[model samples]
Target: KTIFPPEGRHWSILEEKFLALVAEGKVFFGKNGESQPGLIRYLSEVEGLVPWTWWPHEEVGHTDESKKEIQQLFGKSAAFDTPKPERLIKRVLEIATNPGDLVLDSFAGSGTTGAVAHKMGRRWIMVELGDHARTLVAPRLQGVIDNEDRGGVTEATAWKGGGGYRYFRLAPSLLEYDKWGREVVSKAYNSAMLAEALCKLEGFTYAPSETEYWNHGHSTEHDYLYVTTQTLTHEQLRDLSEQVGEGRTLLVMCAAYRGDARSLPNLTVKKIPDHVRDRCEWGRDDYSLEISALPMAAEPKPDDVDLFGAPAK
Candidate 1:
């Protein structure tokens, strides 16, 4: 993923997009100016695997050597101007995906995704629209499969064996206007798709609820969490609070509130705008900003310097 500056220095546009993506459970950002623009790639299909904050390259083991190797390999090529580092992709693959799992990279670029996938014993499918797809993406991936050491992965130990991949180009969007020019919705993903996407975005494991009134989902720790887009009355809060597990924190996100959130014990009622705004801020400004200029002292000579000054006196 790459971070580009706001389109026209329009912070509002960027904020709106950021908030919308966050609400949809996409990506997160740190405090203003402390974050870079990038996409969070999902390497596995696990709930709560998506991070709630941006992780720096240093934090993810992206070393200077690895970065230099990647730049040398694909930086000269005009075909892939924004190629991601293989080490970065490898880390994501290690965390989210397993061996033999299918990995897809629609914007294949320099084929880092495919190369990493091949080395990690996973199958990959890549899509590239440009003419250099063959010259650039293909050769990079071939180097990985054939274990060519163009970038630094030696043939002897890097990819001692071979792997396979299939390339394809998909339409812009599944939805297209008919001859009559009317709107059309594709059946690519129905309710199940929406639920799965929601689950992925919201860091929840999707499950059907026994009761009709409550939606069912759990975190990675198997803690029961209920989310509703409706207001909770006092009776509803009391009843729901009773259903909360012992020694567990009951977090509830609601649209409107009628009763006081402090009334419910062991329950953390999070109001949308207030909670999000409170948690997310531009900067903390905790550090000191004062600066001073002082003259540097010259080193003293052993003979010229006084030896405890009092002995001479």
Candidate 2:
């Protein structure tokens, strides 16, 4: 019979470890807690008894619909918001990957993946395009690494913090522009700003680009997003596809493309303006009704006040 624990208090490592030992004939207990010598008929294999890195039910905070969509689209079991419980990520690393395995989260919103991987004895690389990458993600990770929060793994279990992670900011894409808003052939962009802008334009969590090569940016599921204001030639298309990583699809958004869609390998070239129309308001002024220079209550009159005391001046 399978037994389940209470909501937050799931089975601990010590319980599982002891159970495995008992099943393996390594230790013996006589009647009424009396110690007895054990004879080993077969060595108990504890391979399956490894502690499962699973977040308890209470740790999962996503709603049924949102959770379903995220799982269907990204294959990531967790949601994409803050306060992403550490227990959930811990479970993911435990079940899907082995120790020292490289876990990657391009949309590392709050660095939950990094935190859990670190706790579970795994290596991790995460990318966050939001400003919180520095303000929130870094601090949260620092808290995890330094054991600042007493309620994390240290309080829950035996946690000896030692390792650390290096932080990096993605560089900008558009560095140099001609007077007519065209990219100069030789000019380079500031890496940080370019990375940020590209992520904004293409809806990516992180942008990976070097000088003279603004190749790709990636979100969680989608990768190799290319955005160009100009038309793409066959050679440029081929070069772009080559620069993109292997086994991943390339999503190219440009004004026009002169390549055969069937010929390109794992290439999805979208011709903007024709295939997709701009839905955003252009050159429209939006004024807030609440932002008014006029006084809310034009100078309070003496008659406006109801004086309880008898006063007539």
Candidate 3:
């Protein structure tokens, strides 16, 4: 509200407004950097919930409860020795994150973190290297998704689980080094796998056609990819070119091909391993950042000095 004369000025609030404020409990600091007569407003504030340092098992959960949780999901045979309580995980998640935030538990023992995160409406990634990942962790997460298991913070968070998660298994590296240190596709990869891998590398979706042998994948309607371990002859290329027809192109990856491959208009022929060798890391396994692997920095010259006049070391 605007006041005509807000002259009873204090440092910021006008004195007249301040006195009027004191008289009617209405005068307060106004926009003119002073309290003015009949000019008043108030601001309200809300205190947020304070985070506590201590979490008691009585409130979150204890080991016995966690064991029972595992037992309920998969029976005693699959229970982890060091499984964490779901409520414990829930408490931590509630404090640290909000709905739809991602939670990563790299050491996912019994998948308590994932289950709690999911129930709390958060996305999660759980990694377990042990075999229990399949036997214990996966089954536990499945229970969380199905809504059948409501033991932990499920009821507290009001989560009726329905979302699903993806699972992946790590396979051995696809490339290996031959006797002469030449990079080649691993023998472990069959023709189908090789084709799929090459398709992915070439940015094509791998969808093998049932009717057409040459159709391993396609980048577009007119562009197709064919992968093979067989050595193609000139006649085979001629046949493939004919089948591919006009307004269509084919990328042919073969072990080796006889005769001039460029003569075919529709086919772009490439040699396996030779065309692909540089694209992948071959044969080596250890990728750890070892101290010895790093190039040592030369010791600073004893005569060198920094800008601050400190001796270099």
Candidate 4:
């Protein structure tokens, strides 16, 4: 129905458009019957907006391609079953966020989210609970930063990379329940960590004072917090009340208290463990990735010197 006879095609409505194409040899006739019009247009350019509702299976890539991408970077022998293709992540990033936006991956297995985000110029955070975080994610990100990683979207994105990222480990828990179900401060906490834990619990910053033993930190200049494991007696409380003076408030967190805390108008006393135990899900250790189930080098001892033994330069 779109095709028209010569007279119909030459009508003023259609002639202007067709005459130019005919003159330019852009129009053509059917193979056997020279009367009917053949395909007139040249090849079309690639579509700008390809609907995501249905992409050709070939364009979206397959599981095999994803594995190949990882293998290319890690090596032929190294493979991960759940690695996501960078192209898919790239598509998501393109649609969702802009450059320099922060992306977080809580369960960062092989660091693909971090890798793809880094390649696309987005800031990223990847938290992995296994020791493979050290063996896999860190090295993979480092490779991406150094441009040493030539696989994944490198060819498609032309990612001659340049960027940086920092690594950090979570601190141990501050409290735990004993076998008898008594709440106790974690054995792993050092003096400073204990102080920091108390500061966090009491809603104070951990700013220790050089001159004042009682001034661990403060919520305001008029209100301060003190944290200690020592049992506080009435005499100690009286001394602390005098130190706090007339207008200031002092919140003391201790293992045990023997004083009438209410007698001191500006002082508040809280028992540690008893007050803090129910505050959080205690004893939850944040561990880095392990490449294998086998034991790693024994966890470094607190007082033990360097395993390498050589002094720092």
Candidate 5:
């Protein structure tokens, strides 16, 4: 509108849409309970439409259709043994979830879940450790963006293709040892990981500054948090405070600190181990239920005992 405004800077398609929505009795606050643009309920009324679970392949697509979809998206070479038809996924979404709900596919095979979710206007997270994550999923998603591959629920959903996605290469899960001893954590929380965790814990955004050493995250523009494994001395804290200066406040989480931490109002100092310990269950590896030892069952006396070690009937 900024580039192609017919009525100079006074025209807005949003205003027209709002008026049209008002006439249609659909304009209201967004799902987040805010009367904001973009999020505001527009023409989409099929959000939580519950479809039946007993869907036949005739209604949705069958395994043949799934293979056809793969061929259309990728190629004949991308023949999956049990490919999920897009219509099947659509029905699943209709039955289980509402639009805008998050869908997680742990093993994204041919990235069917993600593709369907994208078309159906649902947020999705696809975790794929295999080679196809890059070769198949990436290309498929790019096709979704370019509005090329129009098989499956594409026609049903009328997907115009305008959303963006982020791709992350996660570190492989490995056993990690802490300073105390060899302990098993699912994934070792490094310094950055610790900082990110602490930031979320303290209700701050995990945004590390490139230039500044102290700024790890921030709740507000002026308020920041710094996480470290080293024990901070009073002198160090003083230097930090000086660096931070007035107006801005910093939350410093470390292993240990000497002298009074409450001396500086700007720097809120906290110990890492105790607080972090409270956040998680660590140290012990064994997580099984402990079976208590029972005393040996007393032998029955001759007077009470029967033929089969029971009282006579």
Candidate 6:
């Protein structure tokens, strides 16, 4: 199986391995002893059906066609250089996923993955750092939801979109450092906001009990989280420990505590600055590059400016 005559050398690694496979009847050498056989049976064909590994021009699609699809939807020249064809995305989704599967695209360019997933009845999370996330992505998704978007596999899939998706912007950090490099709770957070933040941080649901001031939220039925900006004394800790009851454990997040909080078995007191200092990259909440800044509208020419209500001149 060597490219050169076997008289000089044994087969190369590829040829040696292939010849070995032939010996094991896994690959077929031609009946007439052809040098390189056409057939390599890696696996038994499923009902003699083979999926096309190579795509024709139509299946994979070209750049021009992709641009056309974009133009049909957006009704203008696309801002992107190479937006993927909807057909290509649909094909990939068909092969790689099933209905109701969750798809995540971190680099969602023109929101094609999300659009395709939506049409295909898949849940998707699309994250884009550019202005397109607000302008392009959000609008495209809204169109899909309203069944107003006609382009990109819509007709082929019989997609009459009727689904819901929630959009959320990342909240700013809850803790930051000051000029003295001392960590403190963010001034942006109020008492209620601080409580909700602490609930999330401590792995508890943000469900404040109406009957109990200390019961901000719960990790379990008996384990509760309480967040306060006030510094606590030993007397306050003792009182809280006693009030927490026999079976309950109270995790109190405060600005400061005077006594050894671990002394009480039922009470676990964590100081705010110390507890959440290393939890996140403090004060560095907005990580997005925001690739495209908002475009300013072109200023109107003197002649083009409206002057219907102007005084006679």
lDDT of each: 0.58, 0.58, 0.81, 0.78, 0.77, 0.79
Ranking by TM-score: 6, 3, 4, 5, 2, 1
Model 3's alpha-carbon lDDT is 0.81
The alpha-carbon lDDT assigned to residue 118 of candidate 1 equals 83
**Model 2 stretches astray by more than 4 angstroms:** 1-46, 49-82, 174-182, 185-313
lDDT of 1 by residue, 1-313 (tens): 4554444432223457666656775553555734653334354632445353676766443555555655565664343445565666776777779898999887877677877788878888888787767777787777677766355433322567476566554423323355786433234635444344335445778774777334456674535455554677978887877766566555665545788768776576765434434544434677654556656687643223211112221
Residues 1-313 of candidate 2: C-alpha lDDT, one tens digit per residue: 3434344433333556546756875444545545432322333532334464554566643345334433332345434444445556665566689988999998887566777787777898988888868865687667667866444344443566668889876543333456986433224534354344555656676555575354557765546666665788999888777766577777776668786866778678876444332423334587446655775766433222211112323
Task: Give one digit per residue, the lDDT tens place, for model 3 in 209-311.
Answer: 9999999999999999999988999999999999999999999999899989788989999988887766765558886656877887886432121112122
Clash totals for all candidate models? 2, 12, 13, 8, 0, 0
- Candidate 4 TM-score versus the reference: 0.64
TM-score-better candidate, 2 vs 5: 5
Highest-lDDT candidate = 3
What residue pairs are clashing in model 6? none
User: Which ranges of candidate 3 are over 4 A from the true structure?
Assistant: 1-53, 62-64, 177-182, 233-239, 257-266, 274-277, 281-313
On TM-score, the leading prediction is: 6
For the record, the alpha-carbon RMSD of candidate 4 to the native fold, in angstroms, is 19.2
> In model 5, where is the ten-residue run with the lowest total lDDT?
303-312
Question: Over the stretch 1-313, how does candidate 6's per-residue lDDT look in tens digits?
Answer: 5334334333233657555656876554467565544335433532333357886758767777778877777867555676888888888888788899999999888888999899999999998888778888888899899999988789988999899788877667788779998878888898888998889888998898898888899989899998998999999999999989889999999999898877889998888988887565545768976858878888643223211122323
RMSD of each: 23.8, 24.5, 12.9, 19.2, 23.1, 18.7
Model 2 — which ten-residue stretch has the worst lDDT? 303-312
Model 5 RMSD to the real structure?
23.1
Candidate 4 local lDDT, residue 30: 58
